[model samples]
Target: MDRPKPCDLVLTLSLSRGRYGVRFAQDPAEVLAAQSLRHRAFFSRTGQSNASALDVDAFDSTARHVIIFDLASADLVACYRVQFLEGAEIAQAYSAQFYDLTALADFPGILMELGRFCLHPEHHDPDILRLAWAAMAHLVDQAGVSLLFGCSSFLGADPLRHAAAIGHLSARIAPPDRLARAKTADRVALNAFAGMGTAAEAMAGTPALLRTYLGMGAWVSDHAVVDRTMDTVHVLTGVEIAKIPPARAKALRQIVTDCLGYNNTVSAMH
Candidate 1:
C-alpha cells in the first residue's frame, strides 16, 4: 500500500431522487477528476502549495475512493477516500500523518481509514449529503469493515471558536477500548478548554461530517492538533461499525436499499 498507484472503485449507486449519483473511482481519469474536485474544495481554499492543479496524493492509489456527482452539472460534488488496513501496518494510512496510532495495532479484521472527505462549497444541502452518506454506509457493509477511523477537523487551525465542539466530544465520547489511545502528540481536553465539567452542547460549531460521526457513536482524540498545511485543527476520530447509532443506522440502511436496491444480508447496515 506504500507505492504510487491507482485505486479501484468497487461499485456505484445513483440516487432515485435524480440530482446525484455515487460511484467508486474506476480508473485514473476518475481519480484525477476527484483530485481536481479536492483541489477546489480543499487546497484551493486553503492557499496551500500543491504539486499540481489537482490535489493528488500517494494514498489515491491504494484507497477506495467514493465520488458523488451532480447529474445536472455532470460535475463532482463530493468525495471520500477509504483505505483498507491489513495486519498492523496502519502507519501506511493517511491518519498516521496526524496522530500516533500505535494503540490501534491490535484492531481486528478490516479497518477502513477514511480521509480527504470533501464536499463542494456550493452544494452543502442535506439531500446530496444524504446520498453521500448512504454511499458510505454501503461501503462499510460491502467491505465488511470492522472499524472506521480518520482525522476530524475544524477550519482555520484555531481552537478558539471550536473549543466547545471538540471539547464536548472529548468529554462525552470515549472509544470502545483505550487500546486505541494515542502514543504521542499534544491534545486538547475539550471540557477543560470550554470550562465545562461535562459535555457541552456546541453542535453549531461542529462540522456536519464530524457531527454525523459523533451521532453514530464515533469517538475523537483527547485534543486537536494544528495542521498548517491544511489550515485546520484536527482530532483523530474512530467509529465501530456494529456500534453505529440505531436511528442513524436505520436511515443509512434505507439509503443503501432505496438507492441501490441493496439486499439485507448487510443487515441494518444495508
Candidate 2:
C-alpha cells in the first residue's frame, strides 16, 4: 500500500538528527527480530526471554508487522502489528479473544486492530513516538481503514491508582456507535472513582498515554480487564479517524511529518 505523504517542516526538524526508517517485515528473520525487540521492551529481557520473549499469539501469522530500525546503530527501536478485518481475513482477526465480536456486527466499513505495540526502552525519544504515529497514519491511509481500535494498557494490575484518570476519560470521551460500545469480560469490572470530574485540573495528573488518546478523540470502554500475560489492566479504546478533532489531527500530521525525516535513516547502534 502507498504510504502517506511526508509531514511538514517543524516535524522534519524534530527527527532530522537520527537515521530512522520504518518498513513492513518482508521475511521471517525480520519478523523474529521485531519479536526479539518486543521481548526486550515488554519483558525487560535482553536478546530473548525464555518465560516471555516469545510473546507471539494467534495474531502473528495474520497481522502485518511494522518495524522501525535505527540505521546508524542497526537496531530495531519500535514495532507494532496491525490486523485488518474484512473480506477473507475477517474470520481470523486476533482481538476476538478480548472483545465481544457481537458488538461489532453492524459496522458498515473496514476495521483494523492495532496490537502488540512496543518500543525499545532506550529509544523513548518523543520523536520516535511521532514517527510511529506517522507510520500508523500512512498505514491507515493505505488500507482505507475507517476506524482504529485497540486495547490501550496501563503499566500495572492496579486500576485504583488510575481510577481518577479512567473516570476522567469515561466522563469526557464518548464511545463509538452501539456496535463499538466498550464492554469488559466477566473477569474484570469498571471501577468507579467518586468525585472525578472533567475539569482540566481534575485530569491534570492523568497518565500521559491516556491523555494523548483523549486528545486524539478516543473513547474508552465501559470497563477494564486484567491481562495476565502483560501483567496489566487495560481499557478498550477506539477512534474514528474522520471524527478526530480538526486541530488535533492537523497537529498530529505535522508532528509525524517532522519525525519522518529523522527516521529516514537508521542508527547502527540503536
Candidate 3:
C-alpha cells in the first residue's frame, strides 16, 4: 500500500466572528502547548492541578499534531493528533493499545486515527468544534482516508453516570458485530447501558465530539473500556468517509472551502 503524502491542511476560520486558525504543530513548543491543554482538559475535573503537567505518550512521536490557535490572542485553544496508516500498520495505532482491532486488520484502505482531542478548559466556543471537524475533513479528502476511527471518551471512568448516553449509542449506532471487540479486562458491555437513560439525558451527557461523530453517521463498538488513569470511559468510534450523510458532507466541505480560500488569499499576500 502507498503511504499518504504530506497533508496541506491549512484552516484559518473566522469562528464566532473571531480569528481562529488551524495548522500542524510546527515545533516542540507548539506540540507542548497541545499537550498542556490536553492535561488541563483531561485532569482538571479530577482535582489535579500541576502547572507543568503534560499529557505525553509514545504516540506523540509518530502522530501529526493539529493545533487550533486563537489568532486574536495567540492562545492555543484546541488540539488533536492524527496518525495515518494502512491496514498493515494497524498495530501501531494508538487506539490499538486499548481495543481489539483484529476485525479491521484487512481493511484494505487508508485509515486515520484521531487521538488526544481536547480543547482549552476555559474556552467553550462551539465554533471551535466545527473548525476541528472542518480540519479533519480537509485531511480526509487530501489523504483519501477511507476510515476515521478513534476512542471517543466520556469524562468519567464510571459507566453508570454515562449509561444513558452510552445506551443511546449502543441502541442506535453500534458497529457491526465483527468490529472492535473488547480487549480490556475492565470493559463494560453496551448491554449494561441498554435501555438505561432517557433520550434527553443521554444527548445532554454525550460528549460534543462523540455527538458530532454520530451526526456524521459514525458507529461505536459494542463496549466501553474504563481508563482510570485518564478517569474516563471510551468506546472505539469509526466513521466510514463514504457513508457520511450527503448534507453533512456538503456542510463540512463548505467550511473547508472557505478556509482554503482564506489560506490561498493569505499566501498570495505573502
Candidate 4:
C-alpha cells in the first residue's frame, strides 16, 4: 500500500456563522496547547483531578495529533491523538486493556488508534464536533485506513450507575462482523448491562461525546476497564469508516467543505 503524502496528513474546516478550524499539530507548542486544553476540560473540574497537564503517553512519540481551534478566541478547543499502525505502534494499540484483540487476528490492512479525545467544556458547540469529525474523515481517507479504534470512557467506574446506558449500547450498536466482537480483557463480562434499552434513552443522561460515537456507528465492548489514570471506566469501541451512517456522513462532508472554503484551501496539509 502507498503511504499518505504529507499534504494529506492534516485538514482544516471553517464554519459559516461561528469560526471553527481543524488541523493537524505541526509543532510541539500546538500539541502542548492541546494537552493543556484537555487537562482544563477533563481533569481540572471532572472527578479525575489527579491527571496532570501533560496527557502524553506511549503513543505520543509516533502519533499524529489533530486539534480544533476556535478562531474567535484563538484557543484550542478540541483534540484527539491518532496513531497509524506500523512497526512497534501496532503492538501497543490503546484499546488493548478492554478487549481481546486476538479476535481480529485475520483482519487486514492498516489500523488507526484514536485516543485522548477531549473538548474544552465551554466550547461545546455542535459545529466544533462536526469539524472534528470532518478532520477525522479526511485523515482516514488520506491514509487509507480500514479500521478506526479507540477506548471511549464512561464517567465512573461503577457500571451499575450507567447500566441503562451500557445496555442501550449493547443493543443498538452491533460490533462490525464477527471478527470485531469485543472480548473482555480479564474474563470480566458485561452480563449486568446486557439487556438495558435503546442507545438513545440509555445515553440520554450521559455526556455528549459517547452519544456522538453511537451516532457514528461505533460499537462498545462487552465490558469496561478500570483506567486509574483517568479515574474512569472505559470500553473498547471500533468503527468501520466506510459503514458510517449516510446522513451523518453527508453532514460531516458538508462541514469539511465549508471549512476548506473559508480557509481558501482545498486541504489543510497544503
**Candidate 2: worst 10 consecutive residues by lDDT?**
5-14
Q: Which stretches of candidate 2 lie over 4 Å from their true place?
A: 1-17, 45-52, 87-91, 172-176, 179-188, 194-209, 256-270
**lDDT string, candidate 3, 1-270, tens digits:** 654343333323232223667777877888888888899888888888488999999999988988877766768889999988876578888888888888887876788999999898888887677678778988888777898999999988999989999887876555465378777899888877788878999999999888888998988898899999999999899898899999999999998876655532111000
Please tell me which predicted candidate would have the highest TM-score against the true structure.
3
Number of colliding residue pairs in each model: 3, 22, 0, 2
Tens digits of lDDT, candidate 2, 1-270: 653321110111113324566667767877887787777766663223553355666678867788777665667788888876653343355655666545555555667778778888777776567667777776666566777877777666667666666666556534445333333443344446545644674476465556677777877666677676776677777777888899977887776666654535443232
Deviation (Å) of 258 in candidate 4: 2.0
Model 4 ranges with Cα > 4 A deviation: 1-17, 46-52, 86-89, 172-188, 196-200, 264-270
Q: Which candidate's lDDT is highest?
A: 3
Residues 25-92, candidate 4: write the lDDT tens digits: 77788878777776776677555444355666666776788878766565777888887764334446
Better of 1 and 4 by TM-score: 1
- Note the Cα lDDT for every prediction shown: 0.71, 0.64, 0.80, 0.66
Pairs in steric clash, model 4: 13-259, 14-259
Clashing pairs in 3: none
Give the poorly placed runs of model 3, Cα more than 4 Å off. Answer: 1-17, 172-178, 263-270
Instruction: Give the CA lDDT, 0 to 100, for residue 175 in model 3.
Output: 48
Model 3: residue 36 alpha-carbon error in angstroms: 1.0
RMSD (Cα, Å) for all candidates, in order, is 6.1, 6.1, 3.7, 4.4
How many clashes would you count in candidate 4? 2
- The positional error of residue 150 in candidate 1, measured at the CA in angstroms, is 0.6
Instruction: Write one digit per residue (lDDT tens) for candidate 1, span 135-161.
Output: 778777876778888888888767776
Give residue 196's lDDT in candidate 1 (0 to 100): 39
